[model samples]
Target: MKVIGVTAPSTGSGKTSVSLALLSSLNNSVSVKVGPDYIDGSLGSAVSGKPAHNLDRWIQGRDFMRRFRWLSSVYDFAVVEGVMGMYDSGSPVNLSTDYYFRKIGIPYILVIDVSKLAESAYYIAKGFIGRNCIGVVINNFYSEKHLIIVRKAFSDHGVPIIGEIPHAEELKIPERHLGLKTAGEMPDIREKAVHFSQFIDFSFIDKLKDIPLIPEDRKPLLVGGGNIYVAYDNAFNFYYGESLDFLGRIGKLHYFSPLKGEIPENPHMIYLGGGYPELYASKLAEKSHLNHALKTYSDQGVPILAECGGLMYLESTFESKESSLKFPGIFGGSVKMTGKLTLGYTKLNVLKDNLLFRRGEVVYGHEYHYSDIEDSWEKTMQNVLGKGIQGYDGLYSMNTQGSYSHFDLMRYGKRLSGSIAKFMR
Candidate 1:
């Protein structure tokens, strides 16, 4: 599909606003995503009424990542919201959002916050934009003079300022440390989307008409049969649109919520992307039915991939600041919230060719979580702990892999699906 990336300097820079305006403005749109994402999928689907896929490069492998690249032939357009700052999304410089732009070669629509500066906004935009830039959206403009300055910034960069969204009357509410609280978490989020779209130049789609179509050779691998159930809900929410769309390209992908119900039935594969499972540990624990369902399937050798909270859930127990509770007990360890912060960019130097990752392959991605091993519970997970680049910790495991690595599925490269498709087929 014709994909364009939506990016910003840091959180709350109107990436979602620009994304929504574009989704609402276009038809049959999807979102490629990154980070411990939830809000983008929530809002993107709200605007388009389609299930958005999580295309996180960090958490999975290439085969799973591009499972749906051929979607361009199925949908009108695809919009990808960048992970952290363009370059800051990963643990190092190369793994940044800017790096992903070049990796995927998707043209970008740079969203600049005109709050602190007007004409200087161009520099902020210039700093974020790499060579693949296609357009711009000047969000949070204050006055007529501000618009002139922002317009000039785009003109100088040769990047069209698609929309100069004004200081949204709705965005002024307080935010938590993670980022803007979800619109679903807040009732006014819908109104905010509607109100924010007013400021965006909705007609930017017209300019993209000349943007060339992606060649068939580069499309994601396609599949016509077999079951692949992905976790899509308030919890287990870390997903990218491109990744999921790509998955749907190759399998009969279905979604089941870990938040509200049981995992979908009799699936051959399960994908659990990232999300704040720590927030709902007790409730998720209460879903003994679904928990056991996954536990049984994992035990039965259904190929499964879970990241972040999904990884946490597979453990024996989940402990966050809220409360500690029993987990599905599928993996080999107990996860307890660490008093010290446990978060950063990580490079997974592949140890061996296993079910998912290859031997000696290094993957780039980020890790952000407040949990760690409990000193009291060390013996249960003592053998499983891993640390640093190659995860030299040499920890333990079941058939499943649970890690803070958070690498992308797409970058596992073509060997990703090529290798795994045989097992499922």
Candidate 2:
């Protein structure tokens, strides 16, 4: 199998567009994010018609390579899109695309936006020459003339110009505060994928060599036996596919929408993920029956795992920019939709044995939100990496647990599954 990293000089360089386009160009190829991104898996899955995996170097560390190799072995080719710039390090760990490439000894392709450059684009490619750069893909080129000029300039600098994508308005992906919209929300994603594939040259990709695979020794088991109701809708759609996959392995999953006032019936556990809940605050608040059912479930000691937006929905009220809305009032707190952005990787040390974690066990996660919880409740996890709710996070009451941190269950799959099993017992 072949594994290649796609990176650019900086953000908004069309790395994601290029990666999806390349995946569309290849046969039997899968895509993955190099770090912990909440949206990539949603978008990548829409593009490739398969589930995408995240290989976070900071969270998974050297295990990323092992997991990556095992995942890549299942496909004919694997495309890993880098987060941020090519050489940009992590917030706390020295994990970057360059670091990953050198450590794993894999070749990568550089993507450069050449809409405003000709010969000068070669200078940008020159800096990444010896960093296992097999080739470069020029993005945002105007025409064939623009593509030819940039290709010749890079070829003269001993850099192989693998492909060139044109500047088209229709090829743009919609973006929000959290970056691009989920692939499910994007219109005609397959058509956009086709447009992106037309610009890439697959012949060069075919000539590249293969990388040896690493064996996967850890066997994933179905430790839990219960019915899980996962919140899935436009307002609460942020969840890792691997997490749901593990849930499915252990039990059956039933999907419901809080926006539509649907409640899960007789569920062993409820999962409320993160999304644009603040945007639909009034609608969520209007679902009185759903809110009451959730509260009653929590009151009855049915386990409920709530993330960022999920946590916001369980509060006393949500003060959005437009209006103040009421919530389930499970916890005595209010959430305010703020203009400031809070985003980073976080490590959570469990303060006590809870629904998703054991006492003293550390869980790595990502948090991106524009809302803040007001009242302090029983803190369940201590933040060791990013600033989370003034150093302490997670609100635990009865059998309900909520937090702003989005956990990657694949990192702690067995423990999480076992916890759910123990809870059901």
Candidate 3:
């Protein structure tokens, strides 16, 4: 299979847009994001009509390579999109987009935004020119003269120009506080992405060599038989595709929307990821029956895992500019929308045993949210790394666990399955 990595000098350089174009133009292709970004992966899935997966070394550790190889063997072509800038390091040093692309032994294309500059674009591209760089794609260029000047400047360094994309407002995706609007919210995003994809020159795929497939070393771990209720909808859709796949292997994976007043029956475990619950606070608040059902499930000692916006939904009240609304009241605290943004990779020191983690186990995860909870709530985990509230996280009650960190359950493998097995028994 042929693997291509798409990166840029910085964020908003049209990496996702270019990735969508590549997926739209390619055959039997799937998309992969380098880090823990749920939004871009959703966009990729929308365009390719395939489940997009994430490959993060910090979160997945050595399993990253195994996941990459498995993905390569499944599809004819794969387009991996980089998180943030190409060289922007993660929690540890040298863990960047360029690092992963080089490690995976794949050629990457650099995207450059040339909307404001012409000849200076060459300097920007020069800094990123090195090993594994296949070529450069100029985005948002103005005119024929502008494209010509940028092309002429790149001739100095002998950097291959892959394609040229002109400026078009129609191609841009809308954004909110938490990055781009999800593909589910934008009904016509796929059509727009297909139209925008025409600008990319996909002939570069012919020059790339195929990566040999590796043997699948391990099988997916399955817990005891039971139904795992997962919250999925516009209000709560931030979940990893691979994680969901793993969940399905464990048991029956059922999806219900809290916004639509739907609740699962006889659930062995309940998983709530994260999303824009604040946007639909009023609608979610109206679901009194759903709230009561969640509270009853929590009381029954059913293992419940909630993160970020999911944590907000379980609170007594969610206060935003739109409205102050009531929720499931499982946490006995209120969540308020804040102007301050807490965003980074997080390391958690578990203070107590819970559904997803063991006591004293250190877990690595990512946190990106704009809401803050009252400190009066009980905390269960201490944050040894990254910015967590007052050096602590994880709200605990009965068998339920809630936190701001988004965990990649695939990293835990059998350990997670074992934890859920205990609850199932």
Top candidate by TM-score: 3
**Per-model C-alpha lDDT, please?**
0.64, 0.81, 0.85
Question: What is candidate 1's lDDT per residue for 125-215, written digit by digit as tens?
Answer: 7777766776778877788887897788679767777677777565654455445555456665555666666766655555554234443
Estimate the TM-score for candidate 1. Answer: 0.71
405: Cα error in model 2, Å: 1.2
| Candidate 2 lDDT score at position 136 | 87
Ranking by lDDT: 3, 2, 1
Per-residue lDDT over 1-425 for candidate 2, one digit per residue giving the tens place of the 0 to 100 score: 78778888888888888788877767777787877786866777777877787767666645677777777557877888888888887577776877777777778888998888898888976776664787888999898888888888877767777778889897888899888988758858878888887877777766678877765654656455788899998899888776787677777889999989998988888999999898788899999999999999999888888988898889998876677788999988989877899988898889987777778888888888987788678888999887677787888888788888888666665555555666677
Compared with the true structure, what per-residue lDDT tens digits does model 3 show for residues 300-371? 888888989899899899877766788999998888888788888889899877667778999888899988
Clashes (N, CA, C under 3 Å) per candidate: 32, 0, 0
lDDT of 3: 0.85
lDDT of 2 at 10: 83
Residue 173 in candidate 2, Cα distance off native in Å: 0.9
Better candidate number, 1 or 2, judged by lDDT? 2
